[model samples]
Structure formats: structure tokens, C-alpha cells
Target: MGFCGGCAKALLIVFNFIFWLSGAAILGVGIWMIVDKNIGSYFEVLNLDTHDQFFKYAAYILIGLGVFVFLVGFCGCCGAIRGSKFLLGLYIFFLVLIFAGELCAGVLMIVYRVQIEDKIDDALESSIKKEYGESVTITDAWDVVQVQLDCCGGNGPNDYVDSKFVNKQSEQMIPLSCCVLTNKGTAEENPKDAIAKNGTACYDKLGEYYEKGCKDGLLDWGKEHTTILIGVGIGIACLEIFGIVFAICLCRQVDREDKY
Candidate 1:
């Protein structure tokens, strides 16, 4: 029996409502995660209940809509099994509308979250140099250490003093980074801050050091997004495959004219 597209229209409409709402809700959550990151809710899983709302009151509506869509789609597919042209056509459309939106949003998120090291490095350098002096040295791990000549005094708060360090082993390393600011010398403050009130070159130089750590963290996030996108893609592909198989089987079956 030939499948008619008209019977499928209602199912397709419902499917869109389900998928669009689910996607929209998930998008809202993702947006929250990007900006605030403190909202604690996890209703956007990928199962039948994946579309449920976590903390959002409005999510209840979406969840209900999604449930209704899935049920209707399920019933339509069952009817399609007996070659009800209306049923077969509607179920096929339902699968396409529902899953397509979900897959696209997931893919886009993975792409947009990628991090570029150069951009991160530039920001680090700009912020760091604006704070420290030109002579600050950057450790390989991105630690910024301001170098001072043997304790030097100036008219103001930022006088650099020579720093001497004896490690737990009584080892001596006279790192210029040990420079001290004379105002209120507490061990909590880094000696670098006490350096001469110089230009941003110091912060910029120091920032290079900081960038290493920040960039590493950012790259890790980029990699994670990539992996998630890949996983989502694979899952959607699988679902589409199943949906297509069901659609094809329904199309070739004998026609059932009964309304029930």
C-alpha cells in the first residue's frame, strides 16, 4: 500500500514540537552552563526521559510535549507496520523532524567551544604586562617572577628589595624573583608585586608564562567538545538508520485501511 503524506503531517508537526522544544530547552541549559555554570539541573539526557526539565519550571511543558510526541510517533510507527499509508508516512516524517534538530545543535556546540592558543596567549600577555614591570621573568610553567636588583628603595610603596631564599634542604638560590616589596612584607604577597612601578611590559612578559597553564586548560575543553560532538553525531546517525529501516519496512507492507 502506498503511503500518503497528508496523514503524516500531524505526526511531523508534533515531532517538530517535541524536538524543537527539547533542543530549545537543552540550548537554554547550555547557555546557562557557558555563562553562569552554577545552575544545577540534568534533565537533558538522551533517553526517553532525556527531554525532561531539570530545574526549569517551564521545562515541564516541554517534557509533556516531548512525551506526547514520542507516544504519537510510536503509535504511528506501530500502525505503519501493517502498511497503513497514513501511519507509515507520518512516522517517517516524525523521525526526521525530531532527531535532525537535536543532532545539529549538538554539533554546533562542539564546534563553537574550540579554543585557540594564540588568542589565549595574547590575552594573557596583555593582562600580565599591564600589572608587572618589564624585567619579570616567566617560568616555563607560566609562573611570573619579577626580578629586582639587590634591595632598591624608591619614594613610594613599590620599592624592590633583594630576596634570599633557603629551601627546606638549606639550599641557597638567590632568584631575583625573590624581590620584595617593602610596604608590608608578608609571605603571602609575591615579591614581584613590590617591583618598580613600571610599564605593562612586565605584565605582558609575565602573562606569557601564565598563558601556558591557561592555554592547556582551554585546549582540554576544546578536545572535550570535539569528543562530545563526535559522540552525538554517531548516536544521531544510528537513530536515523533505525528510523529509515522502519520507514522502508512500513512502506513495502500490505495496506491496512482500519482506523484503529
Candidate 2:
């Protein structure tokens, strides 16, 4: 290999190193999602009969992809540095597989875009019917969601009236997390004042806290972040293309050098 080939090899090493690090980060995120109680609860709530295993298997798939990418990146780096044609060929094969998988995934997401919203709504409705207070996990998930999204219920506070938890309680009420507190005081500090000033009444004169439903809030959030997600996806795809090209070039250069 000549000067240009050496430079290409060096660039490949740097790119593969970065790719390996990214894979490591993805693996860490997958592990965190799987182990975090809040995430587990959130997945449990979202899981539906139609898509019972989607969330559960998503984390596992992420971990698998992370491991695959990490191994491929490592092989690319080693192949480039050691001028190994066999390892370079292996790296190219994996890159093509990954690229094809991503392309299919992107196509599927586009085709099923409308169904995604319907599925989310159905899952949310199904989740709300269960006993929220009985399970600490479910309760915690709901509280965090309400607080973070600043919203109530699947559709509205009314959705809670039919909930097993709300029906079990003597007084008709929503979770304190739904309330928009005065002066941002803690719900424990002033339960009465925690209720929003303009909030309407639910059944039995219980304050109708947050008017906005999580469904809209979550959908809006997704809409806002879609551009960023697309950009990241494109960037990753470009990186994969570049890796494949460099691997092929290096492999050819190594072959030519062996003939000389």
C-alpha cells in the first residue's frame, strides 16, 4: 500500500474507533432501559395484547445491535491496521447486513406511521383500567409521566373515574401528581392549594387537575423531536456507507500490494 492507501487506512481506524464507542454507548443505554424500574414499569403500562412483546424485546434488540456493531467496528479497525483481507471482507459483509436492516426498518416505520398513534391510544386506554395504586411500579410510572408531561390521564381526568384505583377509593380523585400546584409548592405541603385555580371539578367535587391529556402531550413531543431523530438516522447511515467504502478500498489495496 502507498501513501494514499496508508492515509485511508488511518482514517478507517479513527472512524471505526468512533463507531465502537458509539456502540458501547448504545449498549449502556439498552442495559439501563432494561434494568431501570421506572422504564420497566413504563414498558409494562405500554405493552398491549396486540403488541405485547414490542417494548420487552426492543431493549433486547438494542443490546444485540450494540454488540454486533461493536464487534464489527473492532474487526474493521483490526483489519485495517493489520492489512487483513479476510477480516476486511467480514467487516464489509456485516456493514451490508446492517445497512439493509436499517433500510427495511425505515421503510416499515414510514408505512406504519398512522397505526403507531392508534396503537399508543389503545395501549394507554387498556393500561388505565388496571389498579394503579395496588402496584407501586404502575403508580410510580404514572406519577413520573404526569409530572414530566404536565398532563393527566389517557384522554383527560375523566378517564380515571372508571379506573379500578379511583373506584376503590371512597372519594373521587385523581393523583396529586396531576395537580398544578400554587406557587409551585409541593403537593404534600398544601393539598387543597395544589389544585389548579381554574381547574374544574371531577366527580364528588374532586378537583379536575391537569386538563391536557398525556396522549396529546406525548404525540406533540414526538412531532417536535422527529426532525432530530431523522437527522441522526441519516448521519448514522452515512457513516455506515463510508465505513463500507473504506473497507472495500483497503481490501483491494492490500491485494494489489501482495501481488508486488
Candidate 3:
């Protein structure tokens, strides 16, 4: 029994160390998502104008959870090392709370999955009409999406034809980011010419640009990466469950020893 207790303590310490590192990684990712100007800006732009801060708030929430996890991990480590049942109990409570929250989130995601695409399209269309070129933030966000995904508008190149920004241009031009430059020079070097050969008209140069929209491009990317994401998510959840079980076992061992 003495040897069993020692082994449990060692396992708890090792698991807690891993949990601490995971928390740090989560915090780092959250901070990167929040501060890296172009990182998730495309998705952020899809939110309605009144809810523009949605992504920022979500990042903050993730950071908060990371901090909580980090602190709990530290508590668990100390409790296991010192044979303190109180700290282990506290860690168990926090683990349970986090597990419940994750389960709820997973359920909500499944419940809303069917409506998500329509909501995304509505938000993107609203953003284009209400705040596209009018705001520097919106314009930069869209530019990032177009350049990164090699996509044009929300649904396709034609989605921009009647947009305020394109209409305002004297020559009826989409953003240079939407164009695929065939010229050896940079896109800044007479962008219209860069997008097409000498005789190609702006509207007729459809082949020179991505016909697919950013929304579809992003959806396709998500579909491609879904398997990898699910694997990572499952791995993390399993680690958390293992940590919780270890903490509980350690606490029970401590209690039995104290009673004996």
C-alpha cells in the first residue's frame, strides 16, 4: 500500500506537469489569435457589425480558461507532492467544471451545425454591404482572406460587381488582391495591367481571377482539416480525463491512508 501511494503520487505529478504545459499552449494560442492582426480576421469579418468584437471576446474567454487550467495544474502538482488532500479535492472540482463546460459546448455545436452555414453567409453579406470598404479594419480583413485563400468575394467574383467599393471605382475594378497577377512586376505596378494582358477588359478577365468565393474556400479548407482537428481535440480531451482520474485516485488514496 505504501508503494502504491508513492506510485500514485509520482503519476499525479507527471500528469500535472503535462497539464500545466497544455494550459500554457492554450494560452499562447489564444493570445496569438487575439493579437495576430490577420490570423483569424477573415472569420471575424463574417460577424455582423454590431457584433464585431465577437472573436476578440472569444479569445479572451479562451485565455481566461487557460489561466484557470494553469493554476489548477499547479495546485494539483503541489498537492500530489505534499500529500495534501485539500488541494487535490480543489483540483478535482475544477476538472469537473471544465469537463462539464466542454460537454455543453460540444452539444451546442452539434445542435447549431445545420444553421451555421446560412448564418455565416448572412453575416458576410451584411458585412460587405454595411461596412466593407467604409472601414479600414473590414477592408484589411477581406484583403487577407482574398490573398490567403486565393478567393475573390463572399460567394464568387461576381459578388463584388455591385459592391460599393467596386462601383465607386471609375474603371469598375475589384480589389487587386482578388486578381491573379501574371505580370512579373508586383501587384502595385499598374494592378489592372498586372491582372490581365493588354487587350483583356476588366469584366472579361474572369479567368485571370479566382471565380470561387471566400466563404466556399474557407468551408472547403475546414472540410479538409476536419479530421486533423477532431483528432487533436480528442487527444486533448483524453489527456484532461486522465488527469482528472489521476487526481481523484490520489485523493482517495490519501483519504484511505489518513483513516488507517
The best candidate in terms of lDDT: 2
Query: Which of the numbered candidates is closest to the native, going by highest TM-score?
Result: 3
Residue 80 error, candidate 3, Å: 1.0
CA lDDT for candidate 2? 0.70
Question: Candidate 3, which segments miss by more than 4 Å at Cα?
Answer: 48-54, 109-114, 182-207, 222-233
Q: Taking the tens digit of each residue's C-alpha lDDT, what string does model 3 give over 31-150?
A: 976676655564556652323476577678778888998898888888998889899998888888877765665555445444556587877776666666777777767766776677
Tens digit of lDDT per residue, candidate 1, span 1-260? 33543334333344434444444444554455434311111111001122234434444533454465456556554654344666767666766765675577566645544433335445444323332233223221122212211211111112212211122212322222333324323312444344423224222233111111233443454466557646745664465556555555545443333432
lDDT of each: 0.39, 0.70, 0.69
Task: Identify the superior model by TM-score, candidate 2 or candidate 3.
Answer: 3
Worst 10 residues of 2 by lDDT: 184-193
| Stretches of model 1 off by over 4 angstroms after superposition | 1-83, 98-118, 123-212, 256-260
Which ten residues in a row are the worst by lDDT in model 1?
A: 39-48
Cα error of candidate 1 at position 250, Å = 2.0
